[model samples]
Target: MTLSTVNPDFWKGRRVLLTGHSGFKGAWAALWLCRMGAEVTGVSLPPEGNFSLYDSIKDQLTLNSNFIDIRDAEKLNAVVKKSNPEIILHMAAQALVRRSYREPVNTYETNVMGTANLLEAMRDLAELKAALIITSDKVYRNNEDGHAFRETDPLGGDDPYSASKAACEITTASFAKSFFNDKGIPIATARAGNVIGGGDFSEDRLIPDIWRAAREGESVTLRYPGATRPWQHVLESVSGYLVYLQALAGDDGAHLPKSLNFGPQGGEVVTVGEIALEVQKAFGIDSNWSLVNSAQPPEKSYLALDASLAHKALGWQSKWAPSETLTKTVEWYKAFSETPDIYSFTLSQIDEYEDIS
Candidate 1:
């Protein structure tokens, strides 16, 4: 049951409506779809700091850019209705956990209610073939144990952001059962572990902070020094999402409307200290990264995902090992800073990913 790599013609001329097209993962996914020849309509807020990759590739995409928040149901519905997209990839959310501690209300509203708004809007859309809602691996209740959280495990979260994502999982499930189930539009939710990649300018994430500090020749600060997590490059998770959609569309009854986690194989779980060491090796930097707040906050102890379901069901397995993940990520940022045709470089990566089969 090996899954085939995505066919470029599968996306050729397909209508794709992508939310959060300005964010790191969203921008990458949008560029990938565009390179596959999809007509992309990007809906997102203006980039806060640097120019988004979506903006960099705007001229190359047949896109209708919408500057609107997903929390606004009216605007969300209008955009989806007007675009009349064939595929909906909902990636917009308040994604930072530490920032959630500061803006709890905004985090809950965006992750939970924003998902609700997206589902409600697409309920009546006749043209939509599939919808993939992105959640986080933190949606599981963490007991600080070493057990890998399964999809059937109880969904709970200690912090605002994690809880909001958990709520989104619940909301998506309810919507699928109550509305989208018998309506022919396939709705699925994806919960993947922490995604590390280039082009991520967000605060409170490890890889970007490491990249920033290394680029400036400074040491990085770590909050949870000993915490272990299932880390993979962003493309791993996004590829899983695209594969899930392809499975749903091609087999019709092959995929159930349930939540799935995309992560690396067993034994790939590495601690924060180990990853920091790897990043230092990758960057050719020899320096000490300070550990702050020795007394750990209420963070997960060990988090990983069992991607066997994805393997057996979709024949999808992570191709980029941890070292390759780090190498490719760091290389992208370095190249992006100097590359004149950034869009071509970005699209070229998508072409490479698609050609891997």
Candidate 2:
């Protein structure tokens, strides 16, 4: 019983429209898809922040790059029409939880309505066969009772980010049933766990926070030391998405489920504090962290996902254990700090992952 991989033969010479290609996960996906010989048309806002993975490696990718807001329906529709893609991977969103608190309206607009915009734009593309809407594991209502959420679990959330993603899932499902299914296109939404990897310089994330602390000679402040999350490398979930999309485009794909979950398999629950210690060990630095004494917004104390369906249906399993994931993640940050050819290092990591997958 071996794990499956993204078939490069299927991707060769395929037309793909990838939104959010300027973000962390999107950048990795763009590079991988291009390496597999897919002609990618990228639609995303220009990279923000001084240090972004996309900015570091954009020059190395050969995509039809366009910088536009997904919220702009007219422009997005124009791009969709122009691209005439066979497959679409929609990952654009305001993806930070803490920032969603300050700008809840913007978050909802981007996660919910923005999803609708993409669906609307692509529905009429005669060449389209399949699409995957990327959501988060946090879309489920967290009872915090140490329950592993299944695909059939009730959807609700307290924070703006999670709630908006839940809404996005619902919206995409509606479009899938009402439009895509009728049009003979297999469209599904995928919920993934907390993805950690190199090149994620986004604010309010674990690995990037730790890297910043090491650079500044200070300890990263912890908001929820006791909270548990399902952690996996970004490529694990990305490859899962690619594999599932290929399945959907197959002859029997229309009979597949409309939504699937991708997360680390089994009862591998590690707390935030424990992961912090492991990452510091990989960095060869002291486990330096202290709790923030000030009041902060509420967060889930325990969260996990049941990826049994992905295993049964797609035969998908996470290849890297927590230790290996941490080692590779830390190694990437170190490469960024010490080396200049990040594009080459990133490609090597991708090749390493493919070798094992």
RMSD of each: 1.9, 1.0
lDDT of 1 by residue, 108-154 (tens): 99999988998999888888888889999999988867788888889
Question: Where does the lowest 10-residue lDDT sum fall in candidate 1?
Answer: 249-258
lDDT of 1 at 55: 62
Off by over 4 Å in 1: 254-257, 293-297
lDDT per residue for candidate 2 within 199-236, as digits (tens), equals: 99998888898888888878778899899999989998
Report the number of the highest-lDDT candidate: 2
Worst 10 contiguous positions by lDDT, candidate 2: 280-289
Residue 99 lDDT, candidate 2, scale 0-100 = 95
TM-score quality measure for candidate 2: 0.98
**TM-score list, all predictions:** 0.94, 0.98
Report lDDT (Cα) of residue 61, candidate 1: 66
